[model samples]
Target: MPFLLAAALCSVLVSVLLKLARRLEVDVGQAIAWNYVVAAAASMLVFAPAPSALHAATAAWPALVGLGLLLPTIFLALAGSVRHAGIVRSDVAQRLSLLISLLAAFVLFGEPLSAAKGWGMAAGLAALTGLMWRPSKGAISGGAAGWIYPLLVFLGFGVIDVLFKRVASAGVPLGAALLAMFVLALLVSLVLQGWRLARGTARLGARSLAAGLLLGLLNFGNILCYLRAHQALPGRPALVFSGMSLGVVALGALAGMVVFRERLSRINLAGLALAVLAIVLLARG
Candidate 1:
């Protein structure tokens, strides 16, 4: 239970750090690239993964490669979503990704859906619809792209989670797999940032490096805590998963409102309420 709480806290802290990064004028792309370096290093130190057991011919190389590419991509989208949609909505959208994962489980894996899960899916879908609906007539900075970023966050994260499930199914050690994925993502980020640096589009500096280090620590903490929760809970995976999701949404909303002074529309508030209920139901299911 303590592990679960810690994981939830770490999860929200990632969003908070991203919000702070924007305020501090940190280069998010460069920061994220550096973050992967820190995360990969941390993973290596803590898990001490053996590369011999994770050979390309036997391991889930394709999935690992895909996750390596997708991690940074979704991370950038998540930052954009938090910037444009407010952390309250962005966090809710992210938690609600369980809906997509559940659907995929039913369709792709032939998992049986319980009545509670069905109801939860319905409520979650409604919540997502409400959260994304913009009744106000003011123009956001990136037009529809700004508003759509949350949905992208929702879908992208769901896909990532689904792919991770595939990794688990492939008999790969998660720690080792994560180590490889983080290293790959770090390489990808470095190459992209290097290109941008060459074109005079971005500069590598101390502030971004510091922010990335902090972000990396929190991000790794989130994963470590979550894995610990799973270890502690053993057979109660649903409990840990639901608790993390709900905890992040509730705490993220409070932080956004109190610290950031983010305002949410009535529809968004309703969606938030429905999201909590849906997660509760899904957890029970």
Candidate 2:
């Protein structure tokens, strides 16, 4: 339970830091590249994932490479979402991404669809619609920009989940897959950062460096604690899943509404409730 709580806290804190990045003059791209450096190092130290495992005969190169590409790309989208949309909607939307994976399970992977999951999917779609709505000007500063990034976050994470499932299906260990993905993602980030530096669009800043280091720690903490939570409650997968998801939504709502003072409409609040319901139904299914 402590691990679950820590995981949820770390996840939301990542959003909070991103929200503060622009104000702090932190170059998010540079920070993200550095984050992978720390994350990949932590992966190697903690998981000790082998370098050769990535090229094993059974390795799922497509999925691994896709993750390598998407992790950092979607991370940028996540930063945009946090900046444009309030943390509440962004966090809920992220949790609701499981709907995409659930659909893929039924359609692509031939998993049996249950009534609860069907209802959950329906509610999740509705929740997404409502969450993306900007009924009031106070919802977010930019009208369309508010929803676009959150939508991207939703879709991008959903696809990442599908890719992760593919890697899991390939029988490669999760730790090895993550390490490979992180290393590849680091390389991708560096290439992009290098290009930006060459074009004079970005500069190396101590602030960005500091933020990136902290971001890496929080990001790695989130994954590590969640994994530990699952290990702690191996017999109760639902508990860990629900705890992590709901905990994020709840904590994010508090932070966004109370601490950040972000505003939302009644419809948005209804969407929040639906998101909670969808999560419960999905967990039960």
Question: For this target, which candidate reaches the highest lDDT against the unseen true structure?
Answer: 2
**Cα deviation of 218, candidate 2, in Å:** 0.7
Candidate 1 TM-score over all chains jointly: 0.96
Name every residue pair that clashes in candidate 1.
Answer: none
**Candidates' lDDT values, in order?**
0.88, 0.92
Q: lDDT by residue for model 2 over 1-285, one digit each (tens)?
A: 999999999999999999899999999999999999999999989999766776773559998889999999999999999998979988998999999999899999999999998999999999999988886556468778899999999999999999999999888877898888889999999998999999999999999999999999999999999999999999999899989999999999999999899988888989999999999999998
TM-score of each model, in listed order: 0.96, 0.98
lDDT of 1 at 262: 79
Taking all chains together, the TM-score of candidate 2 against the true structure is 0.98
Leading candidate by TM-score: 2
lDDT of 1 by residue, 91-195 (tens): 898899998889999998899999999999999999998777776553233467656899999999899888888888888887798898899899889888999
